[model samples]
Target: MPYHEMDALHYVGPGWAVDDGFAAKVAAIVSSPGWVFDSFGYPQVRELLWEHADTVVWLDYSRSVIMPRVLRRSLRRTLLREPVFGGNRETLAGWFRRDHPAWWAWSQHAARRAAIHRLVHDPRFAHLRVIRFGAPEEADTWLYDLIHR
Candidate 1:
């Protein structure tokens, strides 16, 4: 499931916050035996989730490398009229919104990468295995190896 599924805005409209309710959900999932999530760096629940997770994967790609992918994805989602997180759909107008993933990705890429760099190095969470890929090919190779193994 997309990380947005845990967000209130995912169910509601165009606002976002990882509230106590969302934290509770994160706590539950993080305690489970086996699962994977893409939301590790969200500040509110990052500590709780990362503390328990065994492995973390970060795709530390450049904004130039990531933006086109984000935009293309948003375009595809809008054109397909696909229902995301709570039956909400992306739109051209929504693309202009600050919280839209495409916009957010472009706007926050640098800041987010820096934050992840700090978190990955933070000693409190050092017990967790961290795998970072700086290029698309590296990530693809890692995934291929994992799947083929």
Candidate 2:
């Protein structure tokens, strides 16, 4: 399912933190076998999901690749006033804010990549199959292989 669909169902808004019950809700949903969960590095629920996950795919694209996509998406959302997760909409004014997706991507990209690198290397998560994609084409190829296989 899409992230927005999950957020809407769980009553969580798009932001740095998930809502009060978000983690618990996610934990419950992912606790069941054969469920796939996607998150933007939600540390609060990482361990919980990791415990049940068999595979973790990280889109470890470089800042140069990510920034352009993020900027384009954010600009489109802001310009079109697209409603995002949980009825939240991006505004042109919000684009200038510190919390904007573009700014967040620019500032946190490296740190986030480093953290994921650490996570994949961590002994505690060694049981999980981790796949890291450095580019969009790689991710596409992975998906194609996954589907064809």
Candidate 3:
């Protein structure tokens, strides 16, 4: 069963699948040798990625930074009818919908930052190199350094 507010399985792409309940397939993709997966949003999948990832690049900019990006993204998607994964398209209606998860997340920016802080300090992730970028220029510098290294 899929929520009407969300996209269905038909919108899946290569290396992307809807994991309604099955965890085994998810685990295999994350831990399988010589394989790299991306675009995980679910808490379970996120945890797996955090644990196995050798380096975590966190765009640690303030809400002042992220809010504008999200706004621009929503605007672009709405204007061009861009196809986000799972046949989802961003819309002003969705952005304003109180029932929508995006609205809730956008409003709870502080909570999200707090959670990320906890994740950074967690002993489980102590072995992970966390790159925190405070500004766009800093992020660009880190990327250049990473590529050259």
- Candidate 1 segments exceeding 4 Å error: 1-20
| Local accuracy of candidate 2 as per-residue lDDT tens digits, 1-149 | 42324445444565533478877777777756566656643677667776677788888888889889988998898888888776688788887888788998899888887877877788888899988888899999989998999
44 in model 2: Cα distance from truth in Å? 1.3
Candidate 3 residue spans exceeding 4 A from truth: 1-18, 21-25, 34-40, 99-105
- With a 3 Å backbone cut-off (N, CA, C), the pairs that clash in candidate 2 are none
**Residue by residue across 1-149, what tens digits does model 3's lDDT show?**
11121123223553335645434555655565544443323455567767866766676677777777767777788889887865566666776777344465577778767777898899988988877878999999877997999
Per-residue alpha-carbon lDDT of candidate 1 for residues 84-129, written as tens digits (9 for 90 to 100): 6645788888987998998798889888888888878999988989
Model 2 poorest 10 in a row by lDDT:
1-10
lDDT of 1: 0.76
TM-score of 2: 0.85
The TM-scores, one per candidate, come to 0.84, 0.85, 0.73
55 Cα displacement, candidate 3 (Å): 1.4
Quantify all predictions' global Cα lDDT against the true fold: 0.76, 0.75, 0.63
Clashes of 1: 0
